[model samples]
Target: MNFHPSHPLQAFWNLAAAPIQAMALEQALEHRLFTLLAQPATAASVAQQLGLNAASTAVWLDLLWSMDLLVRHVPAGKAEPGYAASPLAARFFVDASPENCAQSWQYRARSLARFAMQWCTLLREGFEPDGRTKEGAAASTGSWAQAAREQIGQEQRVVTAPAVLHLMDALPPLPRQGRFLDLGGGPGHVAIALARRLPGWRGTVCDQSETAEVAQDNIRAAGLSDSLEAMGRDLSHEAIGGGCDLIWCSSVLHFLHDPQAALSKMFEALKPGGLLLLAHAELADDPVLAARVMPFYAGVMLRGNHLPQPGEVAGMMARAGFAGIHALGRIDFPMAPVWVHMGRRP
Candidate 1:
């Protein structure tokens, strides 16, 4: 037998990280279960589709059930244990499902728990996350943003906006006469909601051209066009306008390549003592939560955006020159903990 020389224990150390192992298993199971569940097949049917025995089928179904991605049904007095896909699975797995979440994030999920190590290089190199592809700024190859945009157009994202507003209402009131900037304001619902709540406030719905158009349409629909402006712009490039007194980046930060830099930009955009409200999944706020259910949801952020330590929201705010950063209102994404970070620019 040939013996190979080993370098350092650090190599072995690298292989033994728990988070790495958990993330890997999570994605593999997700892909397997997501694809299977989307088929709208029973456990036995799925087993047939995947060429597995009924015993093995029940095991997979049990795993998905434990993960809350599947439901098992044994009709009264029946011997067969039927299975149905969970909402989480159906929302994004079944391509034809009206609630197909796959477009928004299904394709992107697996890429996270695997390829996100590239983010470390970004920090060392001081680059911005432009939602661009490796096509080298020419044809503009991208996977997440474009994919999410396409999917956002396709799927019905009904509960999320209200959920966001629900989170927002739980926060302290914005200062009077404050201009609120809604970065990547999807469909302008949050911004419209904010404007409606605070008649003294004005908003700019900032995002890419197409997304901004959708935001504009939403603003028009809300009859708050006069109070809001939709501007198509690249956040990773220029700094957001400084005229805004309050900045709100909701559900957009995770997709960023350099979330800290973006936070820094928001820090720069605010007036003295201004507030920056980050309304997102709070994935970065719960590092350990990644081991649980978020990998399913985070697969979207990971494929599209880098999910920092879920609990790193405070550290990120501090790095961005934010003072008095407060992360509050922890919620449940599966079993993982999520938080919203609110900070003030000193």
Candidate 2:
């Protein structure tokens, strides 16, 4: 079955194939295949060392190699070829790499796989599995918050503070000693990075109570106590503290129950001429690519969260009394492209 959206019938068939691909990769991760394949070795050798069947190991290696997770080399005068981890696997699949995302994949495999089972029910019921009644909503909220904490490390590593810093560098100059607020910022990584770049700058990371705890730990670990702080506040219902020269809201608005209200609050929270940077994913720009590999995010959208179009966000900024509004679409993060909406309070 073709996972590519090139054919209509194949598209439907892909529904079955996508999860199979994810499961294969996750199973490989569990077996530490990538680590073993850091140096090229015959599949039989791998199987013998890992205590597995040689035939099955060879077939698995060939499958992963076809999927670009491995590379095979046939040595001259040797009867068997050796398999090695691909660059992608070495970088992201290996458990010991600094950029390893095995934990994130593991989380998805364990936690999100449950949601996939309810796709038909979600479509038929027109409500999330955990979003039926008030009690259900509360439970779902708690689950989401806990998920946020669990995924923060992975998210922080993937999206990266350096990436945010790069985005800031492309923009107009930021003020020195700026008062900044990282609204909905999990782990305060971006704020700490930005604060370091702009000397004497202090920023606060505001998020849900549980998420704030995670951010606090990150802040302490970074030794940024003097400049970065985490506040436990719900941005959807609460106003971010005022007097900020710059306010960064990353991957946040779409999840709020009322994005317009939050945007309005952000406008009020910013000082005159202060900049507000809204960073989020915009999948419509490349639907084919998104459909191919971003199935997990599709589930996220199904759960009442959203990824607003750039035009929609610009209109919201205009309505909120923000001027000089503009957007930089398709800012490449490690995992996906993010659209950035920048506006200045008049």
Best by lDDT: 2
Q: Residue 199 error for model 1, in Å?
A: 2.8
Write down the RMSD of candidate 2 (Cα, Å).
3.7
lDDT of 2 by residue, 1-346 (tens): 8675577688678777767777778879989999988899998999999899999888888888889999998999999999999999999878788777787667767766787787788789866445378987668667656665555566566666767887877877865677899898876677778777877788899888777887888888888888889998978766677988889887787687788889998999899999999887666656775653366466657767776753888898899999999886556654456778889998
Model 1 per-residue lDDT tens digits across residues 152-270: 43432444455556776787766767798888775565677678777888889888766677768767877998888888778878667787788877656666667888888888888
> What value does the lDDT take at residue 207 in candidate 2?
87
* Cα lDDT listed for each candidate: 0.65, 0.79
In model 2, which regions exceed 4 Å deviation? 1-16, 109-112, 128-150, 283-297, 334-336
Candidate 2: residue 20 Cα off by (Å): 2.9
What's each prediction's clash count?
14, 0
lDDT for model 1 comes to: 0.65
Mark the regions of model 1 whose C-alpha exceeds 4 Å error after superposition. 1-150, 153-157, 280-288, 292-305, 332-337
